[model samples]
Target: MHTKDDWITTPVTADLLRGALDVERTEHGVLPHRLPARARAQCSDGQLAMAEAQPSGVRLVFRTRATVVELDALPTKRVYVGAPPRPDGVYDLLVDGRPAGRGSVPGGNTLTIDMTTGSFETRPGPPGTLRFDGLPVGTKDVEIWLPHNETTELVALRTDAPVEPAPDPGRRVWLHHGSSISHGSDAESPTTTWPALAASLGGVELINLGLGGSALLDPFTARALRDTPADLISLKIGINLVNADLMRMRAFTPAVHGFLDTIREGHPATPLLVVSPILCPIHEDTPGPSAPDFSGLGEGRLRFRAMGDPAERASGKLTLNAIREELARIVAQRAADDPNIHYADGRDLYGAADFAELPLPDQLHPDAAAHRRIGERFAELAFGAGGVFADSAPPA
Candidate 1:
């Protein structure tokens, strides 16, 4: 057994983080941010702040010969006011881009939320350690993907051997923006999120900006997307807009156009695919500002309900169906002038049939199995012959 003296400690820094747009030096260590500071400053919503800091697609990448690696972090876990404690967020380890193992840290701060009232409170606690042992005993690239749901402040990284930044393999970079489904909610692990799995299959580098409950087409978010460097880009729109009930049809159309215009400012000709939301039964025809269905709260569980009336959609309120139609129209019209813009029906990703085979456990987010199905379907649709990203894969 190795003693404490056998480990070499390395300070966590921005240079080692992948899939993060920016990093903040925290009191304890470093916190990764998907949206940069400027964008973060524009929004005061606690939901978006928590989602971006949770590190859904962020991971530490390094080359080391160590058989054991440990990361120290201060993770802020969420607790629903009346639900059973959530399973600890999972950390996925990959060696040479393949799954090596998974683990989780315990005893961190808890943020208790009252979904019914949109209220929350946080209680602080000490940091914890996450360790992975028995890695292959030679030089290799190792990635420690942070938990996709927990807000983590990376404190330290330690390995038995010295570490260096992993050399880039010159893969095409795919940047994606979307809502919770794309943020790995209910997914088994960080790498199993649809975008991550699709990125693995497509052999591209991933930069996911999939903020949960926060993919509304905010101008700052669009500007961040515009400035971020990427070879190919994708936006999964609709679900969040409907869920938040943030805008009416009059605003949604102009907002969509403005978002696209911002991104095109930086990436004029990049293959930009706009994806509509997957089939969500409750919101398919109904408009929403979805509400918490606490019926399951007695069982220590929680579910969501779309609260908008179907009739309201005729008043210009957004529904998944309406959003999809508008998105298709917008992309088609944009494609006429800018041939690089494309559209994909998200129902193609998690449609009615797939929903039957592997249903979304919650009315909102896809479960782990559904995430896999969506990921595989996305790989086939987006990277297969003649797909928008068909030519993006690195040469075999």
Candidate 2:
């Protein structure tokens, strides 16, 4: 058991956090928000609200000389009505940009969701503590990456020594938005998410707006992107739009245009890359709303199956292939007028051949290994020499 006999308790302040746009003070502690309160208030979907608050790319970053560190947190774990119990959320610690330690705060709140009825119930619980020991002596950059999927409210920070907000590394800020894949779904930890890894590889500071099941090209999200400061930007689209069956081509075309227009209003010359969906066999040609496959629920496994027919495509119903083609065309057309805009086929990140080796376990999102591959591919394609985003990239 960890105690605070000789420890110094420090309040977790907004200045100590990175990649969070805003934060809400909660009874347990501080709840980080990827989307600002204004954007959150414009929407009513509980799913989107929850996704934006999960802290996919957020972390507690500071400089400290402490060898022992403890973080008190309240993590809200999501529990599906029929799925297996989730493991405790993992908090990854990095010292001077190297992985130093990892820990998890056990026993927090639970949010139970019934997919069949689209209903959810939240049960409150007390905060738990995470302790990490054996840090290198002397002042070192410390980063405690919050859990990617769990909604965590930080209560307090206790260390053997004092800490200060870390100095900015002067890396170019890269703001990205996407679906669960970018939100770190199926990722091993927060930092291993595709966007996070890609940001590290690209030598960019990341502000991820990747909300799971909520990247429907909302006006507020576009406005958030418009207002956020970024040297580079990207959007991994199509997956959530198709899986949600949210819109047809009629709505998608203008939605894409409007989203770009809004962001360009603030960053007209910024390098903006529009990425289409990666390979998903079920949704490659078939349209969605995807349905849950409860056949394996008894074995604590759940899967997804596309419910829309291929015939729907003739009627402009969205599919991965259609979305990819349309996105490519849109980017090409926009690039003629906006030289900084570009396009990348998501297939380049994870396609059929790659899928053969690293399959999507739930028939939708990529697993941890696939996330690495996607991140690596994205880094090479977006930040490598001559890549679209390489003009101002950090020295390799």
- For lDDT, the strongest prediction is 2
Number of backbone-clashing residue pairs for each candidate, in the order shown? 0, 0
TM-score, one value per model: 0.97, 0.97
lDDT (C-alpha) at residue 29 in model 1? 89
- The residue-level lDDT of candidate 1 at 305 comes to 89
What lDDT would candidate 2 get against the real structure?
0.92
- Compared to the true structure, candidate 2 yields what TM-score? 0.97
RMSD of 2: 2.2
Candidate 2 residue-wise lDDT, 149-257, digit = tens: 9999999999999889999999899999999999999899999999999999998899999999999999999999999999899998899999999999999999999
- Model 2 bad stretches (over 4 Å): 1-3, 391-396
Query: RMSD per prediction, one decimal?
Result: 1.9, 2.2
Q: lDDT of each structure? A: 0.91, 0.92
